[model samples]
Target: MAKLAESNNLVGRVGNAGDTAVGATAGIRLRKSLPWCAAAILGLVGVVYRAILIAVDVPPANSDEGTAGLAALHIGEGRDWPTFFYGQDYMGTFYSYLAAPLVQVFGTHWWTLRLPALVMYAVFLLLVFRLTRTLYSSWFAVFVTAVLAFGSDRVVKDQIIGAGGYSDVATAVAGLMLASALLVLRPEKPRTMLVVWGGLAGYIVWTHWLALPYVAAAVLLVAWVGRAGMTLRRVSLAVCGFLLGAAPLIVFNLRPGRPDSFSVLLSLSGATEPAAWSDRLHGAVLVGLPLSSGLCAPSHCATWQLWWGPTYLVLLVAATAVAVAAFRRADGGGRRVHAGRLALVAGAAMTLAAYVASSSSAMTPVESARYLHYGLVSLPAVLWPLWVGAASVVGKVGSGTSGDHGGIRRRVTGPSLGGAFLAAGCIALAGAFVVGLSVATGQLIAHRSDYAAQADDEQRLVDGLRTAGVSHVYSGYWTCNRLAYRSREQVRCAVLDEDLSPGLDRYRPYRDQVRGSARVAYVLPSSGTMSVNFARSTPALGVDVVSRYELGGYDVYLCRQRPERG
Candidate 1:
């Protein structure tokens, strides 16, 4: 019996040793993979944070946003064809075409409208990371992308006025610009790159006229860089690709009696309000610094307009100096520093200059933040390379000073200025993440209650319209579509502005019918009604308000258009 017991104890001890060995191996592996695990967790958090915002913001906020969602609903029901931006042939029907399927599958809601934007946002992140990793170090890519994701959550928040309809389109165009810049930096086949890039530029013009400046800047950059290699065949192919991409816009606007597309572009182009230098300075500062005051109030951003110029100016100067110093040191330290590596610098610089020139003409009489909303990452994208060059200078120093040629060390763990640089970087990154992110996230939370109340107001207006037996509504171009979509098309609403007829095969004819003899009511938002201005010009026309609904964001009115009196 004693011998048998001893044999069992020996086997048990061997099993225990095997288990301990396995656990120790796992611990080592986990430690090694911690950085990757951290990146994944951060990415997941960003995605979920965006998702939560989309889920909570129930009603659409921007007039354009409502238009896009409503347009998609019409497309799904086969009531409309994929058409360009309502009233403008400058943009393509790409968003509508892409969003229509999702609308059909999920049903129309604020979240459904933003789902495509969310996916595009993810694509933007991946493409930016790939571009950065290709141009610089992996650690640098991770750091910059993390900071951008943290600070720019509002782009995904769906609550901004102008309704963020252009959010995904803007993000997608920016990603295309980055990818195009990457190709220019390392194009194996310059001809193919030209063709691809040209097609993209063409597509961007049709998607959003606002992005055209960046597209033009990129095309110009690539052409200038590849001037030596621009063969006749390559130029022809590139031109063809660009023309082909723009064919839809061209054909649509060429229909008999349609306004000349270029005329329309010119008409829509130019700044309505030329801001003074102080305003210009404020805007430029905004390019570098995201103040808390700049958020929440999408239209005014009154708080953000305060004196942040000095602060950002100082930061820019310091960053530029540090970056130059680091680059010079690294060049001396035997690292290959080619001036050609400065592709992003040229692209982004020109893009900013072009944007300023173009948007200067489009601003309202008062300084508005609408134009700056799309390029939240432009400054960072431009300046991050300097920061990278700065860090590389540190890395070069750390490598030389480390006595630990004995063992592998993490990238930023050296004892000297190497560690100091890392500390500074982490501090700056954390500060940016905290200030921009906290303000944005806090604004989103604060704004949610107001939007929720807007939802109630919209519902009451919907009920009032139904109660009045109002079969059709002629509302401001922006307001008409949302009221129509939310009412599930039971109320066929048409834009009161003749110029803003939606891009649809049936829209013009449908408008003619609705305006002729239908029992049409008028809906006006409290802010201003585009139709009201038009009505004042025609003294013969009369409008009488039968019922009015007042709410937090809008004052709704139900009125009958009385016949003209002699």
Candidate 2:
């Protein structure tokens, strides 16, 4: 019995030994691959979190989303792609055009529409990291990337893929990528970076109009400050690449059967008289910059402005102070590095200024978020250096010091103190993020019932419109789009553009076709155009409401042709 037991024990020991060897080998391999594994995991977590929000769907669908979705569907199904912004013909087509292929594959659903944002954000995160690592340190790069990936600004959340918000935010991020590229790859360096610069420029000019300013400002600033790096090879290559990127947009606009591209560009140049100097100043300082960063302000109220504007102001001030301090502290060669750092902040400010300076066609009394959504992209440029510099400076100064509690030494070392400062900064950011996310989630939860009823109501309204056999739909600028998009192209829909004085015949072809047609639906809000639709719609106009839908927010009116009085 003893001999048999010994034999079994020996076999067990051999098996245990084999398992240990395998685990040790894996441990060594994993250690070698730790960095890659960490990145993959972080990326996966961020993407999956965004995916979940997109999958669940919240904050309800807005008009901009509907416009993009329906237009994408129109393109996917091989109908006439919208030449410009839906209802407004002057806006760029790049956003809707890019999503058409994906909509073709995935159908006209939110997930497919938002998929591009997810992919783009991932790329955005990567580019930010690369840019930071090149300019700063890997540690700082990782820090900035984390804040962006996990930060919960309402603007970013609302603009995420499938949020169906305008394509401005996504394209603006692309613009920032181009700007960052320009900074990292100075044109005069005579490197391969100019090819990248030109290519990116082409994409920017051809994409969102809101984003063009960022890249433009970056190029001009960099070219001026980086005089040493400017070479003929770089200039030629950059310009050629820009032309290549811009070629498609130019060709598309110039095609035999296309909208007059020059007119669109000309119209965008702003008012003939230009905005009042006072209005321009107001917008640049109060409305444009603050609003662009997701700060809301009322015409008569300064309270909100005081709170939000200064918060960024403080950060910007810190960024400037740090840049100057760094420059003063650096030697001759190091001065260029600090100067570039300062230049980024200056470039961001200049971009903001130029955007504000552009004539605003903002029709509303209150500033709209769309006017400055691109600010979200420029934010990281200012934010990254602020955080990194604060941490580094604090770490350097505060390390090797301790509180004097009855002459008791805390035994703090420079490394430990520096780490604590970093931890503290990260924690503060994390806390703010948590609060923002929690508040957003709470809002979504509290309004869950309201949004639920809204969906049911919208679906019901869609069915009602179809049953009425309504062929044409035009609603208040905000209302027309979602219904039309949800109808799956069964009904033509639009919002009247700003320049409707040109007459119906000069507008989108369908508007002219629908005018005087037997069936038309008007989705009017309680205020504007409601009294006119009922009181002033003349008999000769042959317009009257057939059925009216009273929803929680607005009224949907289906019109009928009055019988002719012969």
Candidate 3:
């Protein structure tokens, strides 16, 4: 009886041990999957938020967006094919091509125009998560993803607005970073990564040259890490990939009569006649930083206080410092972190320098922050140091020993003190992000209604033009392409310069069609240059305003123009 009882107890013990083992395995699986689950949730939340904003028309449609939409419309109808944004030798038509099929299916609505940007943002978030996880810890990846999921209003607009190539630039930069990371981490076989990195680099060059600095940094990092893996054949494949990806740009530039995109890019960069470095640096540090950091009010950020600029500078400096320190003593994963972080810092620095030297910075520094938007791609690297420091401190504290000297001492060790400081820094970052979200929420609520109303007024103007039987007209830069897009070519408008003459005229065919018309109307805003130019310049150009009417904030004047002397 005693032997049987002992055997029963042993069986029960074995069963209990087996159950514990199963539970431990399950826990390990859960831990491994949790970060991925959180990342997906964050990405979904971001996409939904952007979708809601688009539905509400948060940023409102503009001429740039309208031009992109019009390109899509033309491509959809097989009317005309463009390699680049109409009237520009840069900013490839990839976005329009993406939207082409959608325009055909959905019939050129605002949502159809914006859906590509939404998709790009979703992909960008996923890339960001994957890249961060590869370079740092899962915990850091989740944190970075969360930071970007609900960014400030400026960041939101940069990500979601379908204005040609801005969102595409972000996605391309993330892709480049990821490919670079993979090449470094898996250098034994780097052919695929080399091709991917090259393709992304070529695509970004064609998509938006503003991201060139990032491409340069990515290329350098890949070369650094994959030095051993690179061979003549593999490198040739990468070259072929770049040639293939950049075929459109190469073909366009090669065609006779096409303006050199490189020249156009350089002219735009203020490189021809450089600004004073002092002023450029000041603008970059004060206005550009604040604008990109989402700390300044829109449209009038120049006049705001400079408090927001330092916050970004501090964060960047701290992260760069940590990266430099890590590189000096790196081994294994630390080397990868150092390389990734250094590349990001180099890219961001180059972007800032490019902006500072650009004519846009010299002219309208605050307003031209759109150029600096590419810096958003480097955010994961920027936060890596803080993440590592926190983890290191916590680990040291958790593994430390307590000692007694004389009486039992109640004191924190060096690791504990460091942990306290890291915790405080983390709290500050959280607080900053919370404040940014609050401001963004308030701005969205306040401005969404205003933009919707503006869109309505625009529609009213379009309706008035159609009712008046005005198919071809001339308007300011901001109103022309928008009118064309919203009217779906039922009404065509060409851009007029500040002097109310033929200007930019993105699609030359539109201008030609309008100029060929003997009868044209002047659609001028109630205020600003439209008002001043009409009252001052139109009469001088043999433009006779016969009849006039008002449509919301616009004034439409039906006019007849006499032929000009050659």
What is the number of residue pairs that collide in model 1?
Answer: 7
Clashing pairs in 3: none
| Strongest candidate by TM-score | 3
Across 1-566, the per-residue lDDT of candidate 1 in tens digits comes to 99999999999999999999999999968864554555566656666767776676632344566667766887888988854766565556677767788888887666777777777666666655555544444455565566545523234432222233355555655565564555444556556666666676667666666666566656665576556656788778877877776777777777898777667776655544455655554454553234322333332334543333344344445544544454465542112121222434444344444444544523431233334444543444444534543455345433221221122222453335665665576456545544655565556556667667777677777777777676676666556666665666666666655433332422444355455532566565666644455345434445565666554345555555643322
TM-score of each: 0.71, 0.71, 0.91
Superposition-based RMSD of candidate 3 using all C-alpha atoms, in angstroms: 5.3
Top model number, lDDT: 3
| CA RMSD, predictions in order | 7.6, 8.8, 5.3
Candidate 3 lDDT tens digits, 138-181: 76688788777774556666777777688888899999888887
Tell me the whole-model lDDT of each prediction, alpha carbons only. Answer: 0.54, 0.56, 0.76
TM-score head-to-head 2 vs 3, winner: 3
Error of 1 at 372 (Å): 3.3
